[model samples]
Target: MNKKEYLEKLESELGQMSYKDVKDIMDDIGEHFDEGVAHGKTEEDIAAGLGSPEELAKSFREGGTVASVLQKKQAPVQNARQKDTTASAIFVILFNLFVAIPLWIAIVCAIFTVGAIEIGLIAGLVGLVLAIPGFGNFLAAGICLAITIALAVVFVAVLIILVTKYFVIGTGKYISWNKKIWKEGL
Candidate 1:
């Protein structure tokens, strides 16, 4: 194939990709052609070196998602679902399958710890409420319960923050997988 036909085929094969990606690939190929011509390389020789457009296109498509990592601008993550319920359900099912066990364990541990603290707080609160007048001091109990409640709130908040951070990471991975699966199926 001639250089023009080769580049056109490459561009057409890559038409479904983002314009920037296609443009970038074309630019690189254009550079290669120019450099080869400058160095007394024939169109046939350059085309041979580049291989068939279909094969080159297949390589590009099969390659890792380069555009996913490279960008001068980051798009805001839109939470609105453009896909139907089945795909959404599948994503959820896969998500749970991948992370449910460890996620549940962490949550259960946090809940149990919080439950223990709540039990202690309730006991102290009950003691404060039921204390006989002039028999003993309720001041210590109230203060302790207040402090424990505050601490428990902070502890639960920390757990939530940690869990949320990891969940977002897992979600990003799931989205990537879903995109790959969709592309492959197409």
Candidate 2:
């Protein structure tokens, strides 16, 4: 059979399919013929090598239906969504690296410094109690100073615990958000 006969046969066999499918199939087959002719092969030889149009139509119907064509059509959209996801991932990573990480470290160091201050206050209170006897006429003043230091310790301890707890919760939520973006995309 010649190229025209083979394509006409294929088109007739695929008549039940959608217009887009039929057109795409015809275009592909036409290109095959063109390529074969360019390669110095005769139309009859190319049609023989391609097998019967009925068999080609049957294979297309069995395995390459609307689903395959739809997937091809959706490929660009899927690629665009993937690009969006990639951008989100890059933003999250960069933000974590440049802004979030440094800020987190600074807050943690501040917490530690506050903790050290609390320890120092406790030590001062202990020292006041130990030096009370040596204060002599100023023993009342020493007691008042010890009470102030003790109060400061309590205040700092409560502040640090609350801050640390909230910081941890905030960190967990941020990490979860990052995971969600990674898994589900933008």
What digit string (tens of lDDT, one per residue) describes model 1 on residues 81-175? 33444466676566667886567668668766766776676666567556534345766766666677667656766766676678668768866
Q: Tell me the tens digit of each residue's lDDT in model 2 across 83-124.
A: 888988998899899999999999999999999999888988
Q: Give TM-scores for every candidate, taking all chains together and pairing residue i with residue i.
A: 0.34, 0.61
**Model 1 alpha-carbon drift over 4 Å, by segment:** 65-186
What is the C-alpha local distance difference test score of each model?
A: 0.72, 0.92
Stretches of model 2 off by over 4 angstroms after superposition: 1-73
The 10-residue segment of model 1 with minimum total lDDT is 72-81
